[model samples]
Target: MFKEMKLLKPSWITALLVIVLSLLSIQNYRVLPAKEDIIFAAIHWHGPVLLTQTLLLCLIAWQVVSFRKIRFLVAIRGKDEVIQKNLLKLMTMEVIGYFILFDGSYLLTGHPIFSKGPVIIGILMLVLRMVLVWFLGLLLITTYTAPYPGLILLGVLVVNLFYHYVIEMNFLLIQYSQTYDPLWKAFNLNR
Candidate 1:
């Protein structure tokens, strides 16, 4: 079963696409509302949240996919510790990035987390990412495998589509302004 599962590898392009979309969406959100308003309203909108969540999930998927490529136990000697350490590092980075980008700052963004729908969704995504990572690790360890790439890809597509619909419904599309938005300008701390 494990060997069968290892056949699947996530598409690097898709992962990169998710990250790019999420970052662009977040940039859009951060620029829309008045600069003086609370940052939460700007950052925690539906579209931005969905994009961030998708990006994090894609990162997690990539981590597991990479792990799946290596043989669980190599016949060659003395490579086990190095491989294990590297895997641990990758998992740690994914978990940390997921939390920081999706959860940690999110809680601080809105007025008292629960007061806003977007914040709630952000929290949910954060928890979901954590749970997903745990399950991915478990699958890697116990099954020495994961679901087929096709299944994972299908899931990603479904989630992406649902996210797109939600963003559209919320009218949270990323619209680039003709001029650089003040938020971006300020971030650059120029003019």
Candidate 2:
């Protein structure tokens, strides 16, 4: 199974980029309130983020299993016709997974963990975030790869930067005020 699997350099580069950027974003979030409250906020924010990270890992596992199964079947059948179809499916899954994992990391950077919600609600939030991130990734990738689409990619990147820095920050501020601020305050004051 390991012998049959190959990782592309570009995909690895993209993954690294996503991870570094996500970490930077999370660090920015830590400073949103104050240096003294960083630990309090991190404790409050880690639970749901950890859950979502687990789900994302599960998705990657499923993709790997599916790829291995398809490869095994191809080996047993020894058919050329099916190989192309299966390989295409595998590649598509890999690309989709790459984009989802990257974008989901970005989403996790700003999202606060819910302390009192039902487990189902937390799961739903994770799913919704993943879906939204996947959609955004798809749109950006599509535009970037379209014929003579550099201009479109640039436009999309500008908008994405605006949304991330301006719109999402404001949204997070509003959300944290309603949901996370009291918990953070209590946690810090008690400590």
Query: Of the candidates shown, which would achieve the greatest lDDT relative to the real structure?
Result: 1
* Candidate 1 local lDDT, 1-191, one digit each (tens): 33433323324553355445445544543454443222243233455445555555555555546555454444244454554455555445544554455444444444344332344454554455356544444333322244565476456546555644554233332221212244555767664
TM-score of each: 0.41, 0.35
What lDDT is reached at residue 46 by model 1?
A: 52
Per-candidate total of colliding backbone pairs: 1, 0
User: What TM-score does model 1 achieve against the real structure?
Assistant: 0.41
With candidate 2 superimposed using the best TM-score fit, by how many Å does residue 95's alpha carbon deviate from the native? Answer: 9.4
Residue-level lDDT tens digits of model 2 in 1-191: 43343431225643564454445435545344432232223234452234333343333333334444445455666643443344344434544554455445534555444444444544554454445444433443333124544454455445544544454334543353434455566778787
Q: Candidate 1: give the clashing pairs.
A: 40-109
